[model samples]
Target: MPFTLYMLALAVFAQGTSEFMLSGLIPDIAADLQVSIPAAGALTSAFAAGMVVGAPLMALLSRRWPRRRALLVFLIVFLLVHVVGAVTTDFGVLLATRVVAALANAGFLAVALATAAAMAAPGATGRATSVLLGGTTLACIVGVPAGAVLGQEWGWRSAFWAVAAVSVPAVIAIMASVPGGPAGAGARGAGGELRALRRPRLLVALLLGALVNGATFCTFTYLAPLVTGVTGFGAAGVPVVLALFGLGSFVGVTAGGRLADRRPRPLLAVGGAALLVGWVVFALTAGNAAATVVLVLVQGTLSFAVGSTLIAQVLYAAVEAPTLGGGFATAALNVGAAAGPWWGGVALAAGFGYRAPLWVSALLVAVALAVGGAAEGVRVRRRAAGGAGEAPAPAR
Candidate 1:
């Protein structure tokens, strides 16, 4: 909750807008670039791949640099990439820009998360994490909607300009607010730190995190076209639909943060189960305009509520590996981010229609819930054999 954290969040909002606004612009991008909608949707996957691959690479390469300087350099790269993206005519060039911008975004996010944690007043790292993540949640509300409207009024290229424009203010804030100190105490040896990935709990947490988000992007990535084409809402209604989802997301993260620390297992299991049911209901009733609209709000709330809590579980599970924790959790979510759109696109290409992704989403949620159940079952059996009342596991 520091002012500097807020500034970092502001910067994240700028980059995150570029990261997420493409969802709303998929149709326009496909039309302008003369590609199929599925091809256009792959851009989301490319960006996510960049995040998954680049966060750790960049973190390792820049480990010795001053925090403030690294942030500015990353933001500048981000801004330039958006500019390149705005002017590019070829889909290939635009696609490259998405990957590059995501790399820069990932680098900045990794650094900012470290900075936020380093600055937090003892045991408040979770709040700091939430404060930083709040930027992306906010981006979904303000920046993503504005991008859709801009794409509607002017063109999809203008949304890229908006991302670049927003970066200027964030750049100013980083220069003024962040300290010039080093990233943190130098990280421990590679083998010692790398061992954190071996934990069964961490691995499960990572997989569940990925599945939860995959379920979401399966439906969300194509919302623009889905609402316009399948639900009988006009193209102009796309942004409103997105805004409702964003509003629900805002509610979700707020509620999840309050309960996750105290009741993570129940929260993710029940919330994900609820989302599974919601997706089924949504697919069955999507033809009804009123039901579709109401379901968007309900599904959005359930998805983010569980999604946010699962992320927290991954973070807690990886507490021993400070350096790798953020990158791994990030990779987990972006794995879903990359996979969801590609699979959703596959369904579309195979003649499954817009509703196919909903079924895919429901299946992903069920898989995650089953994994959680099996893990819990093993833990229960082990505890009973070990003679009850064992100290609770670190991540639970």
Candidate 2:
């Protein structure tokens, strides 16, 4: 892998820390803001909503610019928003800041994915994309737990301030290391890229991405509550369980990278099934501390294992427009992210217990599994009609 790739991952680590750390901060935020826990959970949805809008919009705006410059612009905006979020006392102001920060986060991640794909050696796009996304998994391991500790010891605002501080060096690293070149210089214009998204295969893949993320976030957004309320842990134990989840995610992403380019379809099927099983077991065993801990690890691994393959599948489906392809994937996934927590909140309001979200997750994953299977069948049929064998194609 290139040094630039790792630098891009570092930047992603900064943004991802802010994104996932909110899960751990929800209880503290609710207590400080004088809002219900469900209301505090809406902050995650608000951030995801911004990403749903920002991904394609930023991709269009930055289509012609050099990748490094675009990334820097987004990172600076993200850092500033975090600063604003750190200092704000008003709940509305804090929520608005999350939206703005998410815009920057979405823009940066879309371009980073496109840039990483462009920089990869032949047949290594899946590996390159996974390596970039590994930052998020690493954030789960280190940043999320650290933020939880900071929130518990100091205040939730301190966590945002910490992210802002870390982002300064991340910005400098990207500026110094990433090459100042237009990524996918020959790629289609915004209009042409939009046209590419009209393909059924690409659309299905994008939807699948959304469903997969929705499934994960439905329960994950409320994981702090689940740990403390349902799993019989104290507030301090939240970070430990979250760290276990992150460890599983790190392992999953690593394995997914190695397999995605080789067997994306089968990987998606198997991973989706495993994730569904994990959710079912989680719902059934929510009251058992040991079972919940083990299932959290299993769920994390299964959920992330499909991530790289899903992204690669979308990229393959939209080979003519790599930047827009990446943006579409980002937007679709975040749409699910936004919806999942909102739906989970609804379940809570409807008098379902904390474990209800796991059932929601399971259903979402089931739908994703079916969609993935259909997409794979389509791909196989197309290949056969064109006289191609069942062998996987080399990554572009």
Candidate 3:
């Protein structure tokens, strides 16, 4: 991997920290802004909505620009929004700021993934992507918890300030490290890219990415409640369980990247199956603390393992327009992020227990496996029809 890849990863870590820090600050924000907790929770949803919109919008706007320049511009805007968010006391203004910041975050990630894919040596796109995504997993482990502590000790505003402060070095690193050139410059315009999205196989790949993430978040969004209410753990232990999940995610992505490069189809099928099994087992044994903890680790690992492969699959499907491909993947994943929790909330409202989300998650993963199988079958048939003389499509 190149040093520039690490720089991209660092930038992702900063933005990811800002994105997820809101989860821990919702209570403080609600009290400070004189709003309900559910209202404050909307801030998180707002951010995901912004990502869903911003990914393609930013990709189209920056399609002609150098990748490095696009990344720098996005990071600058992200920093500015965090500064504004830190000073805003009005809930509406703060919510608006979250959306704006997420736009910048989404833009940065879209460009960075394309740039990373373009920069990697032959057959190493999956590894490069995994390296980039490692930053986000690290944030879940380190940055989010630290931000929560900062919010609790100093105030919620302090967490925004911390995000802004940390972003400064990421901006400088990108300026110094990332090469300036029209990377992915051959990508088609917005119209052509949109047409590509209409393709059935490409759509399936994108949907697979969404379903994989949706399944993960469906259970994960309610994990704290499940840990305390079902497993009988104390409040203080919630962070520990989350950290364990993050650790598993980090390991899974690292391993999944290598496996994806070698065999994306098998990894996708096996990872999805593991996730489905993990969720079913979790739902059944959630009352046992030890079983719950182990299942959490398994779920985290399988979810991320599948996620990385799905991303690689999408990238391969949209190889002709890498930046737009990345944008599509990001948008699909964010849509899942927003939808999964909403569905889980609906289940909870209908009087399902905390474990209900796990069952829902299992169903989602099973759907993903079916879609993935369909995709694989299509690829194999296409290869067979072309005869043995023609090369098969990439495993993704």
Candidate 4:
């Protein structure tokens, strides 16, 4: 592990903290802004929407820039956005700040992952990406809890301010550690990158990414309610349970990285299957508190554990276009994050049982597995056909 990877990892930590701290502070924000909880929740949605919209836009624009320079610029923008978010008075101003912050976040992450891989040893890309992504998982485990405590003691504004403060050291470290060079000369240039993206196999991989994430989040968005309401936990216990879920995610991401390095395809298949099992367990055990707790841990673990493998799959699927392909995969994940909660909310409004979201999520996971299987089959068939054509040409 290069020292710079750790620096890049710190930048990711700051961005992840900013993105997730909102969930813990939403109630505080609702109270301070004189808005309903649902309205405050929209702030999170706004951020996700911005990420989905801004990632590709930023990637395309920065396609010609050095990866290190791109990372620095994005982090600076992210820091500024957080400062604006901390001080904004009106709900509309806060919303705008959130959007800009999310844009910076999306750009920063997309570039950072690429930079990490660039700096890593050959065959260490999976571990490198995992290390950077572990920052996000760590944010859930450490940052969110700290932010929640800060929000409770100080105020919601304090949480945002705290995140901004963290970014100071991150920006400094990023500047000192990451190197700058000309872009698009890495492995392949922009034209070659774009050409690789045109492959059908890569598109199939992105579709699979979008589906898996969308379904996982659909179940996750309502986890607190299901825990408290259906599982018969008190409000006070919900946070504790959620904290456990976060810890599970932290473990999952790290473990998944190791397994992915060993076996990418089978690990992904196992992850998808585990997610399906989690949903089924959640649906079946919602009325049993002990079982529900166990299932929630699995749910969070499976949802996040496959993150590294998924990125590896996407990059491999589009190895011809590493940076752009990874960026698009991340953008798809953000799209799912934004859409999934909305989908779950609809299920709730339709008077579905508390466990309905889990069942629906299970159904989507099954679909994702089927799509992945189809994509893999396509790759194998194409390889076989190429071999056959080569045999005949050699004979001729």
Candidate 5:
């Protein structure tokens, strides 16, 4: 509920836009740089790979730094990289900038999550995290499309320039609003945080979170092809359907935030099952354009409602880890984000129909549920023996 949380959310909006906007700029970048589209697309992969590696590493390196300082430094570096990316004439320079920018993005997001959750009162961490995530979803709805339009009208470089400019206000907000204390001040140092990873319950939750996200993204990455080719929606209608999905995601985040801290297991159980069912139904109904449209919104809502819960689940599950907890959340999601697309591409290349990703998504969600159920079984036995297993891993 703090205004500072909103500012943190603003900071992530800038970062999230940078991540997704590259999809729109790929064609322009490839043509301008005299490279193949696939080569230009590598910029997106570089960013994902950077986030995947950088989140935990940056969080660890800055674990001792003041939270405000860490966030500000990341924002500055992010802004500078975008400026360099916009001005550079060489493809290699641009690629380097993407990786550096992603490093900054990951570091900032890691700290921001910790900062937001720490700022929130007890029982409100889920709402706080969702507030922050809402900004990222907003970027999907607004920022990515605007970047594409800017690239179309001006140049792809202009889109980069726009991203840099957007960060200026966010940087100012964080500098002015964010306090200078380290998150979880005086907690056990990085060693205690590292030890959190050894907990079986925490590890299972992280894997569950990863699988749910992998399912969400594997379907998301392939939605365009499925909508256009199988549903016969036509290329011009793609944005409309994608926008609907984005709106559904925003709604899901809002709803999930209110309920996640209250009863996460039931939430995950019901939502994950619904998501799995939705994916299967979508695959079967791909030939029906009207049904396909309805399913996009349904799938988006179910996927994010469950996915957002897992984000909160992981953060709480790694409570001893604090700042590292935030990094863990980011890293887990990006791992899925990276793998989903790679695996989806492989399916398509292997001659699986456009509908194949829906089935793939279903399998990922089913596995996540099975894993969650197993973890729940272990949790019950531990609780029955003694009340020792209820600290951070309680309820979820």
Candidate 6:
């Protein structure tokens, strides 16, 4: 991978850390802000909502700008937002800061993915995209845990400060490493690119991402309660189990890069199947600490492993607007993020078992697999009809 890609990855790592660490600090936030735990979680949901709105808005607004400049501008916005988050004590102010951070974070990654595709050699597109996306995986492993610990020790504000500090070096590296140029030679801009939304394949990829994320989060959002309620464990053990999940996610994301580079179809199929199996195992083993730990790891792995391929699928489908395509994928994931917690919370309210969400998650993955199969068939037919010079289909 290029150094520029690494710089972009670093920026993503910091942002991901900022986002996920909120889960660990929810109690602290609730206590400090004098709100209910569920209310504090709305802070996280607010960020997700911002991402849903921000991704496409930023993509459309900046579609004509040079990618390098766009990235730099967004990173600056990211840093400023974090600064606002760290300094604010008022609940409303903090919520607004989180929204700003989400906008910058979502926009930066979308542009970074498009830049990765533009930077790569013709045949190395998947690998390049993977390098950029892998930052999220790395963050889950290292950035989030460290941030959680920082928040636990020094307060949640300190954790946001740490994330903000990272943006300085990220900005320096991005400025020094990424070359400036005119907008990409092939990518369209503004009004011309809006039509890319009409593509069926693009819609398929977006829905696939949405479904997969919705399934994963349905279980994940309630994991702490499930772990404690079913296994009769205390709060102390939850972090250790969650860390194990992060470890598995890191391994899966790295492995997925290699798999996507070689056999994307089989990798996606296996990932989808793994999600179903993992969720089933989770539902069955909810009462066994050891078994739940193993299942959590597997669930994390399968949830993350298909990320690059699914994202690559969207970009390939919307070749005319790669950044917008990436933005769409982010928007879809955020929509799923919102949906998952809502549905899972509903199940909890309905007096279903804690494991009900996992069962629902399994069904969602099964649906995703069926959708992916249909998409694969369409791609195969498209390839057969397309000329030899046509672009290869995206991985899903």
Positional deviation of 335 in candidate 3, in angstroms? 1.1
What's the lDDT for residue 381 in model 4?
76
Count clashing residue pairs per candidate. 0, 0, 0, 0, 0, 0
Q: Write the per-residue lDDT of candidate 5 for residues 198-261, one digit (tens) a residue.
A: 6776677668778887888898888899889999988998998888888888888889899888
Best by TM-score: 5
Candidate 5 runs further than 4 Å off = 390-396
Clashing residue pairs in candidate 6 (N, C-alpha, C atoms within 3 angstroms):
none
Preferred candidate (TM-score higher): 3 or 4? 3
RMSD of each: 3.4, 3.0, 2.1, 4.0, 1.5, 2.7
**Which stretches of candidate 2 lie above 4 Å from their native place?**
23-43, 87-95, 152-154, 382-396
Colliding residue pairs in candidate 5: none
Query: Per-residue lDDT of 208-299 in model 3, one digit per residue for the tens?
Result: 88887898888878999999999999999999999988888888888988987888767777677878888899999999999988988878
**Displacement of the residue 108 alpha carbon in candidate 2, Å:** 0.5
> lDDT per residue, candidate 1, 247-342, as tens digits?
787778777766766777777768878998999998898888999889899888888778777666655665555545666677778889779877
Q: Cα deviation of 354 in candidate 5 (Å)?
A: 0.3
Backbone clashes in model 1, listed as residue pairs: none
Candidate with more favorable, higher TM-score: 4 or 5: 5
Candidate that scores best on lDDT = 5
lDDT (0-100) at residue 19 of candidate 5? 98
Instruction: Predict model 6's lDDT versus the native.
Output: 0.79
What TM-score do all the candidates reach, one by one? 0.85, 0.89, 0.95, 0.92, 0.97, 0.92
The alpha-carbon root-mean-square deviation between model 2 and the true structure, to one decimal in Å, is 3.0
Locate the minimum summed-lDDT window of 10 residues in model 6. 387-396
Clashing pairs in 3: none
Task: Name the lDDT of candidate 3.
Answer: 0.84
Q: Which stretches of candidate 6 lie over 4 Å from their true place?
A: 33-39, 182-185, 377-396
Candidate 4 lDDT, tens digit per residue, 82-141?
778788778888988889888888877777767766776766677787788888878877
